[model samples]
Target: MIVRVIESDNELQQAFNVRMEVFVLEQKVSEDIEIDELEEEATHFIGYEDMTPIAASRLRFVEEYGKLERICILKDYRGKSHGKELIEAMEATISAKGYKKAKLNAQTHAEGFYQKLGYTTVSGEFLDAGIPHVTMIKEL
Candidate 1:
């Protein structure tokens, strides 16, 4: 998988499409909640296999950390390490931007995956977009 920082409207739309498939369609998250007001303020990323978008995520500087948000991989692409690649790319960008920490509200089912990537759960489970999630943080 090739992960790139989204730099064009077309690339951003591709990212949104992947998110729609994974989050809104498969997970049943509402479109209104999935695509929120923060879109304009976040730096988005899209991962591609050849020319096909497979994964998507976004980063926002919050306080002293880079906040990772809306991370997803298309259903067909799960378990292939594309998600990990996408995350590493985001983390690299966070560090490059001089942030010393990264944080995210990870869906409970995916908490273990984030742990293996060096994130530590810092908060109890909470509901977000009607799904269970916990806040996780990692030092860059």
Candidate 2:
């Protein structure tokens, strides 16, 4: 997988397409919530296998952390380490931007995955977009 920071409208759209498939369609997250106002302020990332978009995520500077959001992998591409690659790319970008830490509200089911990537749970479980999540953070 090749992960790239989205730099064009077309690339951003491709990232959105992957998010729509994994979040809105598969996870039943509302379209209104999946695509939100913070989009314009976030730096987006998209991963491709050859020319096919496989994963996507976004980062926003929030307080003292780089907030990771909208992370997803296409159904057909999950469990192949593409998700890890996408995250590492985002973390690299965050560090490059001078952030000392990274944060995310990870879906409960994916908490272990984030843990393996060096994130530690920072808050009790809470509901977001109708799904259970916990705030996690990692020092960059």
Candidate 3:
């Protein structure tokens, strides 16, 4: 897997396509909700397999930490450790930007995965886009 920060509009579009497939199409998330205004302020990342995008995520600076958002791996790419790699790469990217901490609102079902990556749940269960989620944080 080749994961890198998306530096161009074309690359951003590729990442968006992957998120659309995983979130909008497969998970039935509303298209209106999946694409947000943060795209302009956040730094995006894309994971590619043999030159084709297979995963996507974004990081945005909050008050004192970087917020990880829109993490998605396509259905066909689900079983591997690509999602973990994506988060790791995102961490490296944000860390390079001088962030000492990272946070995310993880889907409840995926909380264990984030826990395995050293994130601790910091908030009680909540709903985002009608999906159960919990806020998690980790030190970079």
Candidate 4:
């Protein structure tokens, strides 16, 4: 899979489109809420398999933390660890920006996946976009 970080509006559009397919279409998240204003200010990553985009994420510095948002992998690609690769890509991008830590709001079911990637649960479970979620963090 080709894991590419967004460097232009075209790349950012690809990343956002993948997120929409996985998060808005598949998961039923409101399309209106899927695209946040932060997209213009954050660093984004796009993961592609054989030149086809499948996973994507975004990173933004928030105070002392790097916030990871819009992380998602296409259903057919879920077990292949593309999601992990995407997160690792985001980590590299954020660390290159001099961030010390990374944070994400993960669906509760995905907490274990993030945990395996060295993220620790930092916030109690809660609802986000109608799905149970929890805040997780990892020190870079």
Candidate 5:
């Protein structure tokens, strides 16, 4: 398994497919917002298992708000290290971009994962894409 940032349309397509599988089909999130205006602008990271995309995320610098997002992973790949690898890649991308911190709105059930990766909960639980989530941040 090799994990890295998305650098081509092929990788980007794989990342999009992963998101569609998890968010749209498995989680039933709205397709309208799943691929929104922000996608084209956000930086993307992806993970491949034997050259097949299995996990991914997007990074967007919200200017004054900080670098936020990139929190999607494949269901079948979940208990493995793909999610963590994706986050680490995002952190590296943030650091390279000169961002002091990175943030993400994590699903409530996955709070522990982010926390383990050095993120701290900074917001109360809220519904996002029909699932409970909490905003979290971590220094780069």
Candidate 6:
């Protein structure tokens, strides 16, 4: 398994494909909302398994910290810890930039998963793109 920042258009497209399958198709999130204005400014990462892209995530430097967003693993790759790998790669990029913390709005159902990865809830449940989520943060 290999996870790294996207360095080419092909790699970026692979990340989009995974996100599209997980967020747009499976979760019913509108394409307009899932693909947002942040793409050009955010740092993107893609996870590969034996040369196949299986997961992706994005990190954006927001104000004082790094924001983790658009993290998803293809349905066929679920339960394999690829999501964890994806997030770690993003956080590594954040830490390399000298950020002291990282944050993300995690879907409620996956809060515990983020918790296990050292994130603590900072905001009560809220709606984003019609999904129940909570802000979580971790010291980098």
Question: Cα miss at 18, model 1 (Å)?
Answer: 0.6
Off by over 4 Å in 6: none
Candidate 3 Cα misplacement greater than 4 A, ranges: none
CA deviation > 4 Å runs, candidate 4: none
Q: Candidate 6: lDDT over CA atoms?
A: 0.91
Tell me the spans in candidate 1 whose CA falls farther than 4 Å from its real position: none
**For residues 52-134, could you state the per-residue lDDT of candidate 3 as single tens digits?**
89999999999988999999999888879999999999899879999999999999999999999999999999989889999
Listed per model in order, the count of residue pairs whose N, CA or C atoms clash below 3 Å is 0, 0, 0, 0, 0, 0
Each model's lDDT: 0.95, 0.94, 0.94, 0.88, 0.83, 0.91
For model 6, residues 75-105, the per-residue Cα lDDT tens digits are 8888988888888888888888999999999
Whole-structure CA lDDT of model 4: 0.88
On lDDT, the stronger of 1 and 5 is 1
**Candidate 1 lowest-lDDT run of ten:** 74-83
Candidate 1 residue-wise lDDT, 1-140, digit = tens: 99999999999999999999989899999998899999999999999998999999999999999999999998888999998998999999999999999999999999999999999999999999899999999999
Report the alpha-carbon TM-score of model 1 versus the true structure.
0.98
RMSD versus native structure for model 4: 1.0
Point out where model 5 deviates above 4 Å. 64-70
Cα lDDT, model 5, residue 67: 59
Show the colliding residue pairs in model 5.
Answer: none
Alpha-carbon RMSD to native, per candidate: 0.6, 0.6, 0.8, 1.0, 1.4, 0.8
Error of 6 at 139 (Å): 0.9
